[model samples]
Target: MVPMPEQSPPSATHDVTNQPPPLAPYDASADAALLEGLRREGAGWAEDGVRLLGLRAGGTEAQEWGELANRHEPELRTHDRYGNRVDEVEFHPSWHHLMRTAVAEGLAGTPWAEDRPGAHVARTAGGLVWGHTEAGHGCPISMTYAAVPALRAQPDLAKVYEPLLTSREYEPGLRVPTEKRGLLAGMGMTEKQGGSDVRTNTTVATPTDEPGVYTLRGHKWFTSAPMCDVFLVLAQAPGGLSCFLVPRVLPDGTRNTFRIQRLKDKLGNRSNASSEPEFDRTVAWLVGPEGRGVKTIIEMVNCTRLDCVMSSATLMRKTLVEAGHHTRHRSAFGARLLDQPLMRNVLADLALESEAATTLTLRLAGAADRAVRGDEGERAFRRIATAVGKYWVTKRGPAFTAEALECLGGNG
Candidate 1:
């Protein structure tokens, strides 16, 4: 009789509740600060395209793409099964998807190609929106965008590569630059001994019989996006440190001497491949005046710094949005978390910081737009503002994200 006692079914203890819904399927362009800044920064005409990209970036598919891309980090293929040297970085399909979308939306080097007003501003706005999806892919995109001005230092090189760099097509693979529908760019400035002090680089560039052509010999400690079609490299020339354009594939369809020593084990940004590339007899073309590598690459550095500010702003905004959503739907102490005065204060503070970053970034974008239009005042402002913004905004990002994560308690 005791054995016949009915066993009680296991009581359910895993019911999901008090959790905010996924943040996708909402309009990322609906960001009040971003929209206001876009209009204020003279990119109002691009609002529609920005909104479209925002929607795409906020979709479930794009969210999944980001997750997958990060989860499956880029793999460096140093050699083929047949023992052939194939210094290629293989990425997940999702990575390619993100890249394709970014290129088609003109978030790479398109602004430099466009002759319209606010082109840079529009590109900046679009980049801010799309960058919210993922940060790693933005590396090559930013470099591609930055490479335009530096490449212009050598008009001959610019004439050959600029068109592809600005093309609204995502052509992945190492091929002759002219053969590709579009191209991406990367940069190699630092070495093992010299990091930010690029002037100390020891890579040697020996000029060939052909004018402007040189052979590079040395190792780059950090060269991100090695799979890119081209890279802006720094090396020691007869005239001193100088900048050179190194392509993965030479014009004759032969692989250049870009040996990927190994991929960097980074703390973050795993979706991008950062490598120590050994340049032994690597074919390169000199860019800018000899002995003026720093001056030649400064513009590219400024553009990348602006991108850093935008990236920081995007991070702050995304975290704040997550926190806000969680507080609105999550309840504790017999009321919605959003209703708590202390939580409200925290949210208000985060909102203020996020808005400030957004406003500052857009202002810099405006300055870039006007500066490119030959405004000396705007150019000067952009130079100073970009440096300050890069320093401040990027520094604030970790703290801002940490605080926003705290808002979600353990859920974060």
Candidate 2:
């Protein structure tokens, strides 16, 4: 038996070849399109910050953080060990780290707090840069950013929460609003039977003895960022469908009746938690004039739609970069893939698309900045352009990603 022992097979079959190196450690802000658009759109003051964020986002550490956060996803804790209803969604530590960086970098609602000329434009540039690292965590950040304008509908409520909401501190947990260094907000509009038709919502909000307060009783089908400190919810009030601010914890530090029925099993955005929450006797404060829930929440919606456009552009840019990097290093048919005419054409087309998206996104950010500064013409332009851009850019994302992925062959 010892004499019959055979030699091991050669290891050449396992050797790696023609593989593209990892795409990290590259400067994301080096994009000529983004930098040019930033200056042209009046956000040139933000170039330094955007470059810093771009460096961090493109580093290997941030890349690993994004991978780990998505891989771990979020876990729903509906109850404590003692059978107490906790209704908490626990995220991986990596998720928290990404969130901390985002908040510290003023990627959320900080623009509203700043008195600079191009604060919104700067914030938008920061978002576009940091968002390249991870997309899921941007949900809470965007909601917090959008919540400020809608919150302004009720001046007193805005006074109490706006500062905390716009603060750069990233405090997690359902603490009393006044006690937290900062706060994040979520939205609960789509109901089980209603979906986008919010007017069909059956959630009822009965007035409390205290003026401007009510108790909500209904279920939300898609309540994203369930762990946020507060939510802007739509419910049927005595007057009609109205908007209300629902805090997770009361001022006295008691948890609200935000029953997390279950976490959604989504096809993507796994790191962000979406839930079906039942608001049984959930205390809420009216946000605007009664029977004007749509009008009140539309401000938040418009802001989020702009973010959607930015997000779609981010995905396109990321995928295009990946494809270009892969083709440059990979070889096939006796030469480097990138030098091939067909592959070069594909990459050139993708680059054009990416540049267009980036330019349009930054232009819209400029419009938003002007609109906030009381430019009626800019406001009107944004109202139509945002919706159109969101539709076209987002709709083009899947196809663009698909084409870019095809360039990577099996590796993608």
Candidate 3:
């Protein structure tokens, strides 16, 4: 009553109205360095693919799909309504849309399918573009892409899987590979007992009546993309550690012994499912020769490692674009942040870092193609460059992302 007698209303501030709207219509592949570098490095064949990704990145649909996929993390369904063990991972519709888009865009195994010159470079470029949208889905896409070379070690398996791997469709479910329109491949190598070293892995693979058939008995500490139709798993054989191709559905359409023990609660990559599974006499087909599992899967590992380089470069470029866009709109003091000398220098420095990373990653991608072509120099370069690129680029990624986020100040 005393306050009402003063006849003064409480102060009202429209802070929300004063806030800046989000930046949009950003073409991720329009980076001058990326386009120019791809052209100069003989990967211009991927221009169309990169441009398509640019369009998607700028479009509201793709951005919303990425956001929704992240917002709705995958859920693990170990059983059905009747308590039947299904061991399925359920993802939002957005995740399937993203996966389908990625697969249809040839971001997975198109290079291997086409087998043309500059395939790896083209695929790597496409990967960089697609990876920028949402990184979690890249797991299945990456493993599918990487599995090609390793699958080649077994011609029959390659014959059966290659076509499905390259298909533009993204069929999600636990079904026989022969009945699906498309397929994704997963890998299981790491275990709780041994993270990177497969030497200590104790999962046993017992040979069956069939020459190349075996039964796997052990657990996989990490089986990424559990929804995939097939997994290239490593287990102990009579000849020591070996690689085997394990499928979710058996040949008779019945579910295999593959049991999803639990899904890891990872801090990041929440949109993707990484699970722990126990296998009791899981049916598997031998890949490569006995006792050569490490050597066989090493090809797949190397491919994924190079992908890590491209991914790191892509992350840096994405962060820079976001920061630059924010600075152009936001003002500090009396002038726009973009006009400030210190902020300008910081932005320029970040751009340079991103450009360098892009250049180096694309260069290494080129080296991979040349290495495949039997160029001694490139092969030698790739051997050392892969290790160095993977190490340095990944090492700089976290710091670069942090600095770029800092540019947005409190908004970030």
Give lDDT tens digits, candidate 1, residues 1-412. Answer: 3578766666664677899988887666778888899999888999999999999988889988988999999998899999999998899999999999999999999999999888888998898888778899999999999999988999988999999999999999988988999999999998999988888899999999999999999999999999999999999999999999999999999999999999999998999889999999999999998999989888789899989999899889888988999999999999999999999999999999999998899999999999999999999999898999999999999999999999999999
Worst 10-residue lDDT window for candidate 3 reads 9-18
Residue-wise lDDT of candidate 3 within 1-412, one digit each (tens)?
Answer: 3454444445543334324566555677888878877776677977987887877865678778888999999999999999999999999999998999889888787777775667778777877777767789988998988888898899999999889887778899999888999989999999889977888998999999999999988998999989999989999999989889999998799998889999999998889999999999899998899899999999888888888898899899888988988888888887788899999999999999999998888888888887877889998999889989999999999999999999999988
Q: Flag clash pairs in model 1.
A: none
TM-score of 3: 0.95
Give the runs in model 2 whose Cα sits over 4 Å from its true position.
1-12
> Given candidate 1, what's the lDDT at residue 304?
94
lDDT of 2: 0.93
Off by over 4 Å in 1: 1-11
Off by over 4 Å in 3: 1-12, 15-19
Rank order (by lDDT, best first): 2, 1, 3
Q: Please tell me which model should have the higher TM-score, number 1 or number 2.
A: 2
Q: Count the backbone clashes (under 3 Å) in each candidate.
A: 0, 0, 0
Clashing pairs in 2: none
TM-score of each: 0.97, 0.98, 0.95
Ranking according to TM-score, highest score first: 2, 1, 3
**What C-alpha lDDT values do all the predictions have?**
0.92, 0.93, 0.87
